[model samples]
Target: MNSPSLVATASITSPHRVGCQAGVQIGQACWELYCLEHGIYPDGVPYNDYGDGNLDPFFSETKEGRYVPRTLFVDLEPSVVDEVRHGVYRDLFRPDDLVTHTEDAANNFARGRYSVGQEVVRKVLNRIRKQAEACSGLQGFMFFHSFGGGTGSGFMSLLLEKVMEEFTSPSMLRFAVFPSPRMSTAVVEPYNAVLHASTTMEYDHCVFVFDNEATYNLCINKLHRAIAAIRVKKTVQFVEWCPTGFKLGINSGPPTVVPGGDLAKTNRAVCMLANTTAFREAWARVNLKFDLMYSKRAFVHWYAGEGLEEAELSEARENMAQLERDYEEVDGHDDDLMDNHEF
Candidate 1:
């Protein structure tokens, strides 16, 4: 028989590549699966979300295509919910009126009504529960909420916690697309509280966190208009790869933070799916912390000692420096510093 600790630690790893299907509720649904699959039952006791506590994601993909959305969680704002009730959610569901209940709930949540918030939360959870039940069982979920205004942050974390109560599969993964830091403050305050509560919540699972700040940093450092353009369904794969790749490394043994050029190259190799010459050239120049060498281009070039244009390499190194600065800033965090967990 398995020891108690082993049993507790037992968790699921995705056998195949994971993807986010964003036409609907992406955040809520994606996170559930990411946590469940990635969760590690170290010594048998299941760890909570946020790796330091419990459960580590397993499985790594060498190719960018490996990260795809299987489940999705649509983020409903009070206004959007109102629209849904009067419009979409109803038509999408069935039986009667088409009005957005989520928008109404958003108003209630922001007003900070304990009772109204609970009801709104409950209704949203119920919808998720019903959907999960319909699936018979789920693998992972995609979180599609904007990290802009207050409503998204106020309830996103709470929503995940509630979903975990009913959808207790193996590992629950949470993937989210947060807004840029400049845009997040209005929402981050509330998001901070939610994140704090979520970290402590027992039912909470691993979150595939996305930060608007992080995205912004990438865009600014890389001299790109928007991070999304390069991603175009490519960002999720990179994000998924980062954690899962790290997790897999740990499972195989343990991991140490990779550094210098290795880290940047690894991140670039995984982050960019388009094999454009520019992208390939870019990856060659940057260094990363965890050099799993999980990318084909990385390995091929690594072995061959490929060359990059001097100008391209120079710009890429600047981006790498920015990343290094940002990573260091957030790595040494405490509860007091929680407000700064950018990505």
Candidate 2:
């Protein structure tokens, strides 16, 4: 039997674009407002507390009720540290919370100009592992990363890898808003990051992808665009879909082609259960369905072949069972009751 190469796994690592953080916050805030109006508590708080003027910022809980907005600085440029650390971006993060790629590390990668951004990513993964463990007891970590630009795409993938490596015991779920090639970035980095991330699906799962192009088409003017993009009328449901042992990362293109026909338009929602019997049941209950039809590859036609070895596929299936069981047990806990009812 042939081994399950990265190509085969890559097919399953499909990603959806969820527009920018502003859009996500708008969506969440709308949901929170709706819930508040109906006399129910909001689930996850939107990252932007001040307003939509700033890009989406990362927020962490202090184990106490306080929210600590942290800015993690990771990039191939040392100047980015200065930009984020002391410049206009300084207002975003807490003091002493910024993390960056070493000057030597970033310089080497920049000089070589590798497409992967592996070295800088390695540093980011290590730092995040430590930070995530320390903050694990808190209300989980939230990242407001953009799918556009080089640093956000590169660093987001790397940080995700490290979190998976360190946290095996029911790790905190990740929520990402992928940028549309037409809107988030006209550059090539997002296209590259999408392909790379897709190829490495064994590393992460349940990404909320969105496209800027779609949003742009929907909005008529800047004011309408701002309002429409940031204000989706729905409750921000924080669904924690654990990795379930089988990791799924997304990699696609700087110019990936969207699949043709209805498939081309549909936003594929994938629910991965760690190849186990228990997880199968959980997956059945979860019923993750793709509500929107968005193209997986937006423009670039980079195609990675698919096929997994029988043994690897079997193991993934087995893991799914345990994950399903774990999901029911943990997810079953009533967050609504706990939030409203005091001890």
Candidate 3:
């Protein structure tokens, strides 16, 4: 048989309780959906004698014939990890794969990137390396993280840098939860978000940005599910160079709602995979906010004390400004270039 194309997923959460809870909820929902789709039980055993779909991408079979998900849950704090350890799907993960640290990043990017995060990064990397070594044909990595929190933004950025250095061939895709000021959790969110984006721009192959405000608005309006994809695509703009930026799929079956979750039952679901330039607008907004706070040197000492230099902040701002321009450039067609010309 040909080598299985394996893809690993890593869910990195911030130290904050809210961020950790959200990460775990999403991870649980994903595990539940995968189990249902592959006809696997919560304990990782086959549901029936009929083996139907391919599970190689997301699962690895053990010597005892149990299939465990190829996923990792990471955080700088252990409370959320402990919860998952005792949760309903506890049997679905290996103990070593769920990595955590005793101390937290304390909502500071510099602390996560340079100080406390460094203490646990090696352990996290070793776990990732172990996962990669098991695959015969490893395809890529999928990261789920929040953009506005310390561990999610700063520690994740540090991890991305290390991953790029260690595994150069595998593509990296991110599912980033963008921050909304209306539902902001911390005063330094803008700083974390901007710095995270600027640092990881080159590391990520593609990113799917999720907005809590948009989701909250959708729920409040009780909008039709069928038109949601269309509305979202209409609002976002993609680059002209990439024609297949948006891919939409309709699943006949309804989404698998998590137990005790607030999501309503629905008949159908629309999933949209996108690579758009619209995220540059979010970067722009955060950068503007960062500048407003940074002009007065507010909260600079916290990061500086944690080993972050003032020059790096200036460089990050410049990097984001250039990134915005790069997006704008890609969105427009180049009239000077002839399609028929050959290199």
Candidate 4:
């Protein structure tokens, strides 16, 4: 019952990369959990405090799995690479994981830079393909992106098409969040979003949608009702299994949820909520602010502009409330549909 490994890829330009940051957190958490599970005590703490962690990267293997950890980083900005390589998350990501495919996309839209984005992704995908060739039982893929920008939307959609085209059998899930309309992004976000919508619908087995506005409101006005604790039985698993990379699989757990840092904590929480019977009650404590750290925006003028009035903002709040209701209903329906079939 060992779950397949996950390959979490995010464009440097998009905020969705925040979710991909879990590689660091999960690795640490898993080490701690492993030490606690095993009889190891270093300075009275259960973690990788005892060994160099190089001779053996993993501490345990059971029905849950002990995947060999490796990452492939993809982005178009050299400056972004500098930040990641020399920044706070250096410990979470390895030097080899950074692909160094630089493409300037600050002032462009998805539709504007479609070709160049594809070229950059081609290089990164080649690297992922190499991983697929080398690794055994490498399950499916989980793509993280926001639909409101050029790289995340345009590049993400293209990557999905290519992934689906090359590896037809593996399942793909898109973890998508919306860009703020009046908050602080390009007005063309609407355009990038609409362009990405068709491709996303075409490729993804499931598109888990979240909105900045709704999450913000939940943390603000509904902190008491944020996403609650998840309830899963020992044998249950949410994601499927596949033989190919960038494809679908119903037999394995999502790699994003297992841990290291990008969205390790949040995805773990999400997987919990995704399986439980109490949808609304379980949706009681999802930390929006914590996840917001990955949401980097170059557009600050939107906040200063008068183009988005208070009336629009009020309506936006209402939309978010309605969206949550829709999510609860859909999530439950999805569970039922999946339960009827086992692949």
Q: Can you tell me which runs of candidate 2 are displaced by over 4 Å? A: 1-71, 87-96, 102-116, 136-139, 169-181, 184-193, 221-343
TM-score of 2: 0.38
Q: What TM-score would candidate 4 get against the native?
A: 0.52
Where in model 1 is the C-alpha error above 4 Å?
1-78, 81-99, 102-113, 146-150, 184-204, 222-343
lDDT tens digits by residue: candidate 4, 1-343: 2434445555523333332322222233443344444434422233444443321222222243322334455555555555556754454444666765545444244432455575676677786676666545656776655666666666666777777777757776666666553343454454345446644555658766656565676567644522122112222233344212122235343233323435544322322113233333222222132123213432323322412233432343344345456665644445455445222
RMSD values, in order shown:
21.0, 18.0, 6.4, 12.8
**Per-candidate local distance difference test:** 0.32, 0.35, 0.74, 0.47
Tens-digit per-residue lDDT, 1-343, candidate 2: 1111000000001123322223223223332333232222232233333333221123344444333343244444444344435643244344444444443221111111234355555555555554554442433334444443334444455455555666563323333444443332233333433333442357554444443443454353332332233235322222447423236665341222222313333334444332322223313321221101112332222111111122332243335445555655654544354344211
**Tens-digit lDDT string for candidate 3 (1-343):** 2344333333434323355544554666678887877778889998877376678888899999899988888878888878778988889899998888887777778888999899989998898888888887788887777787778788889999998999866777677778776777778888888788878878878887778776676567635444457545453344457544546566666677655667777777666554555456667678888999999999999999988998988888888889988866865523233122121
Between candidates 1 and 4, which one is better according to TM-score?
A: 4
RMSD of 3: 6.4
Q: Which candidate is the best by lDDT?
A: 3
Q: Residue 238 deviation, candidate 2, in Å?
A: 21
**Which one wins on TM-score?**
3
203: Cα error in model 1, Å: 4.7
lDDT of 3 at 218: 55
**Alpha carbon lDDT at 41, candidate 1:** 24
Ranking by TM-score: 3, 4, 2, 1
lDDT at position 313, candidate 2 = 24
